[model samples]
Target: MTDTPKPWRIKSARTIYNNKWVMLREYETVAPTGADASYGLVHIHNLALGVLPIDDDGHTILIGQQRFPFGRYSWELPEGGGPQELPPLEGAQRELSEEAGLKAAHWLPLIADVHLSNSITDERAFAFIAWGLSADHSFAKDSSEELTVRRVPFAEALKMAVSGEITDGFSLVMLLKADHLLRTGALPPELAKRMLAGS
Candidate 1:
């Protein structure tokens, strides 16, 4: 689709459902072809956060859990949602610690304002690469979650990502982006050397 000024003109809008985290809205609109259309949009209230925490030993952490929406097990990098009012980095750091039980001494922004499933939802994600990691036993995983954490080599994670083993779009984007940064000399030499050792 081409970007245009007012491709879809909204005639009327109404909220269908809303909760603390998300709100669903219905819109009556005129399409690009001037045809009447109805569009449903899910608005996420929180900014999605994802972190690829790499330890000094060339290992990165992943979390395994049963995704409620999909009703299946998923392996993904440490991820969660953060309040929109706070800085995204704060949320990334918090989720890295809470979900993976580890925190990093260094952080690199991989990407930001990532639109996930934009066709139906306005969910945005921010991803970071965290290195110089150490243990933090104060993990406070959400009570609603039953998570399994796995520490894997950076290379293996890359492989899993490319092989479709890591299916979460947020995690997949972060992993591939990290790999691209590392390979393209975009990362600090010291960090790249250490992480690439596992590949």
Candidate 2:
């Protein structure tokens, strides 16, 4: 006989709380081990979006702001949330322009459908590497956000991510993946050459 992996089976579920942003639900589940337990799930309603805007000079943009949940200031890639119905690339472009005042002529999907915190929340994230950027001065910052933008060499940003200075999971993942793609020649030869030049 062959053994097959079995997933947790939900016996019953009910919403405990819900808001515009997220929904909390309680579930009675039977584990693969046949043990019964209760699980709390947080379902995020929006798709998380992230953009690494790389300029012609091989620099990337970072945004610094006070993250309310962490109760501390954090420096991370340009990120925002988009409606679940919106295409990920479109969302990335919007976030990049809104947060960094830059628009990209080319975009490559870096990571797709990444479950940010799967153990507790169904929060997923998508990221893109954008290049051939131009400034858009008319872009306005989101009224609720007060951000500080910095343009740094791509190599420096990767170092920051590696050193834990850029602790935001989404940003860290994107930076590391970009570094990998560039080193492995997975990106366009011309772009990869320029990116590695700054390293």
Candidate 3:
């Protein structure tokens, strides 16, 4: 007689807490790959957005914000995460307009991937690259935000990221990826020059 595979099942799933920005969940499930033992897991799923704004002058827009958790200020790209169902490019557009009042005439998908770490919560960050950026007359910001937007040379952004000045994981990843794109001639000439100059 052949042995049948046992289906993994969730013993219990519960939400420990719920808030505006995140939810905490506790789960108990039978081990899927091993014996009949059960296991418990805790996960916090947070939604986040990231943007890469490349100006015609070859510069990129960034922001400097004070993170209360870290008790220090860090350089970051325009980004946010929430429950809104906007598409990735649309999210980038919203973040750009809200944070910097800049809009892109051209946009493309940079990456969409999971950001999972053993030490931190399980989440995913979506990144987009935008071009032909122009500043609008006004920016509508959320009440909780205290952001300072700045246009910096793309190369300098990479240097700061490598030096740990831009420790925000999403920003670091986006900048590094942008740099790779620039080096590979994947980015426009104006943006490429600006990225190389590190303005």
lDDT of 3 by residue, 1-199 (tens): 5988766677788887777665666666666575454343335444578888877666788898888888998789989874446566666777888988888887767778657453336666788888778876355798877988888777777788999878888888898888788779997676567556655
lDDT of 1 by residue, 30-123 (tens): 9988899999999999999999888888889989999988888999999999999999999998998898888889998998898989899999
Query: Model 2, which residues run further than 4 Å from truth?
Result: 137-139
Q: Give lDDT per model, in order.
A: 0.90, 0.90, 0.75
- Tell me the spans in candidate 1 whose CA falls farther than 4 Å from its real position: 1-5, 137-139
What are the candidates' C-alpha RMSDs? 1.8, 1.6, 4.3
Better of 1 and 3 by TM-score: 1
State the RMSD for candidate 2: 1.6
Per-residue CA lDDT of candidate 2, range 85-108, in tens? 989998888898899999988888
Q: After superposition, how far is residue 47 of candidate 3 from its true place, in Å?
A: 3.6
Clashes of 1: 0
TM-score of each: 0.95, 0.95, 0.81
Clashing pairs in 2: none
The lDDT, on a scale of 0 to 1, for candidate 2 is 0.90
